[model samples]
Target: MAVTVISLVVAFLYGGPQALFLCVILGILEVSLSFDNAVINATVLRRMSEFWQRIFLTVGILIAVFGMRLVFPLAIVWIASGLGPIAALDLALNPPPDGAAYFPNGDPSYETLITDAHPQIAAFGGMFLLMLFLHFILEDREIKWLEWLERPLAKAGKLEQLEVVVATALLLITATVIAPDDKVSTVMIAGALGMITYIAVNGLGEMFHVPEEGEEPEGGPSGLAKATGKAGFFLFLYLEVLDASFSFDGVIGAFAITSDPIIIALGLGFIGAMFVRSITIFLVRKGTLSDYVYLEHGAHWAIGALALILLYSIGTHVPEVITGLVGVALIGAALGSSIYRNRKIAAREGEDAVKTSIP
Candidate 1:
């Protein structure tokens, strides 16, 4: 309620009632596009301590809403345009000049600036997300979803830093083949930084992870032991990066609705982000992932799909609706599979109990 009210007020202040409507629409669009992000976030957030969870809800909200939605875009524009922060803000608020090539159809707008930087942004976000998906799929786990593909990847995981190698190869191929000649360097650098950022943050998380004294380190450490103070901090960083990677697509897609940065922030930030955070908390508290065992598998697969879409988007424009639908479909299918598997298990257990009673 507070988020809706605040969003309404912000929209009104930015551009009257019409702006309010657009803001609401953008908010809905963001929520629809990012539902999978909420699921993935819940998976990680469930591992952190209560204190870290609270911080994610409170402090993290501030960063997601303001840092990523507002300041991040402005920072991008500033760096790309070589404008001062104030000038960039002004550029964002006002329309573009006549005959400006950056603005599509000669319409000067902040969206133009953001659109112009899409290649680099897409490269960075795509590589980071791709690496994340690879890490999840390649790691040896008890539950295997697509065994035919994942099993081989799990075997390959035996090779040292194989995920990193695969990700680097993909980045190089993308830059060399798909990216335009003029933008090749920019794409390569951005993609490399994305991979580096993932490795650094992931390493930091592992470094801080302290296994419990008596627990066997099967997969490094027990969840409880791994959620220490320092580990939680690094986990927080991981979640933030994950959120940022998801937001790259959302932010770029928001332009399809409207170019006003304020409206985009009000829509995506106040409403969409608040909803995602709430969903994450709800899933954590309810243990949704545990109940639906395959849900995590589905989410990771969705992430893999999304990562590919982000990478392909660098070469061509993919509609936001298509991206959202693909994720939703994967998650929905996973839920169905989980339900089916649960029913089968219950039936088998019932039959066993009946046979024992007869004997």
Candidate 2:
């Protein structure tokens, strides 16, 4: 809260009331879009040690703010536009004049350059997130939220490397059929890298993870496992990458609100990212997921929707609100279901108590 106040005050001092207002809107937008992210983050974070959680809030946030939101976009522009580092930074700070062509002429703005590179960015983020969703849904779990659908997917999970095979096939189809001819290579490469990253990080975590005595080996991504040592490191890395994937679309969409990178950083990166970190920590500490059983399911479903949205975005434009709303809607339904189930359980317990008391 203090950070938000300071941030808005700084914005006002720097760019007047308009900047302050934009910052607030961007911060709100980021929070709304990433509520599911907080839930998912809590899942992995719960498995992490307190020290690691502190590192996540501090060091990890630095990476999210500057690494992903600020520097990464600048790097994207530099690569796409073939500009010097200093020049790229400058172009980003001072985009094209207000009335000129929006993209790719003699002097394209940073937004244009980065937007042109969207195919690769989307592919990479999309494939990674898709793998996450697939790993969760396809794995056999004792608990099932959408039993009708999850049960079948769990049975299919018995097939070795089924998730990988499915993910690969989707990537290939998106690259060859959905993506433009000129962009096929970039899409394939980026999407492949996304797949490889997920496999490596998740695989490393799973390989090093040691279940406690009598504990059944987890069949899913192993996020439920309280990993330590090398496994913990990989889990931390996985969380960071997951954060980057979730932030990719937001970082880009912020341009639509304000071209100023500083405001984008203040709104989307600092205030917004801080809130998400806080929310994750709160959820972990409170063990809310244990009470609301369907949240994780809802979050993963939202992730699947987001992954497909990102992949589809490579070919065409999607309203940013749609992405956020999809997540909100799925998670909302899950929360409702959880409440209903909890009430039903309580009622049954009450009835049993009455019968026992009468006897």
Candidate 3:
């Protein structure tokens, strides 16, 4: 397929076997870390026509390469410069760069750039995701508060997740107001920007969302397919965003092993994404979710662990490998349990069938 060719082309541009290896490794790692995201995304994909599903994967590629692998580091650099000097030092000390692009003309050591940027990226990503997850958790799923408010406006769409994001923004603003006027403001600003991004992306999803029945019900997204569709799309969107967050550590950490940013990006971008996509397909085709009750439970636990790692990465340096291992262990345990459960259920069903035959 075109995607496969493009992935290889990108890898070739980065150059070398090491680049290929890293791309494969990081891609696999990303997919594994984000299994829950894939499952959740599938829920949305089910609603979309086959055409839309392909679009998701294609757009997803763009997000990973341009947003996470490329622009994100620069954004983090901006955040670091805006914060204090010590923050930058903390980030830079970890690793050195392999090479430099033409625009900069100088191959600033990875260690130096990271240290200069400060490690606040970890906090920015961690807290931002944490808040988004919490909003989903706390939102009034049972009641349509937005529907009531929109009665006068005659809006057909329910409030959706927009309220949760706004609430998060408000909370960040409050924190900004209460904190000391110096560095806290900078951190708060970063957090706010993160939330704003969430709003922007989710808004795009809503805008592009082509619900059946042409218009959503007064309550919005009713029925199993509709509900799962929206949730899954949001889940997919969140996963991509989450993957972007996870990549910060992976890309930065790649330098500790090698200095080439091209290699780092290629390694972490294409191969990593492919592995995850393959896993996602397997899970979907096999009906892993339906077959194993606790699979989702395990994935959420991994998500939580990754979130913690992201938060900790702010003040303390946590290796990307450690984060990957923790997630793998959790998901592995879940898969094992699922196997045992399926066997037990099969045995019970066999017994019942035997008894009926005897009669």
Report every candidate's CA lDDT: 0.85, 0.87, 0.57
Give the Cα-based TM-score of candidate 2 against the true structure.
Answer: 0.93
Better of 2 and 3 by lDDT: 2
Deviation (Å) of 282 in candidate 1: 0.9
Model 1: per-residue Cα lDDT at residue 173: 83
RMSD of each: 3.0, 3.1, 9.2
Candidate 3 regions exceeding 4 Å error are 1-32, 35-37, 75-111, 115-118, 132-185, 192-239
Which residue pairs in model 2 clash with each other?
none
lDDT of 2 by residue, 167-207 (tens): 99999999998899999999999999999999988887677
The best candidate by TM-score is 2
Candidate 1 versus the native: TM-score? Answer: 0.92
Worst 10 residues of 2 by lDDT: 220-229
- My TM-score estimates for the predictions, one after another, are 0.92, 0.93, 0.65
Each model's total of backbone clashes: 1, 0, 20
Please give the lDDT score for candidate 2: 0.87
Candidate 2 — which residues are off by over 4 angstroms? 99-105, 210-228
By TM-score, the better pick of 2 and 3 is 2
C-alpha RMSD of candidate 1: 3.0
